[model samples]
Target: MSKKISYEFLEGIQLPITVKKDILEINKESERLLFINKIFQIF
Candidate 1:
């Protein structure tokens, strides 16, 4: 289902050695996605 796809897509990523700002942005976005996933599981 959609949930499994999202989970795997996130899991499949490999972090790059990059600028601090870029890393922070990616972390924030992933955290938001994780929060949304938790909400989906709750309902």
Candidate 2:
């Protein structure tokens, strides 16, 4: 999932460093939201 995406981005040498960092941050936020949603669903 996210790991695969991050790995692909890391391998993309043509992409700027700032863009890669931004993408990673976005991925983290999405993952965090998904985790929170799952917790709420359980309760």
Q: For model 2, how does the per-residue alpha-carbon lDDT over 1-43 read when each residue is reduced to its tens digit?
A: 4556455645754557775565556557557445434545986
lDDT score, candidate 2? 0.55
lDDT (C-alpha, whole model) for all candidates: 0.48, 0.55
| Span of 10 residues, lowest total lDDT, candidate 2 | 31-40
Q: Which residue segments of model 2 deviate by more than 4 Å?
A: 28-43
> For each candidate, what TM-score against the reference?
0.37, 0.39
Candidate 1 structure quality by residue, lDDT tens digits, 1-43: 2344444544565534342234334445556466546645986
Clashing residue pairs for model 1: none
Query: What C-alpha root-mean-square deviation, in Å, does candidate 2 show against the real structure?
Result: 10.2
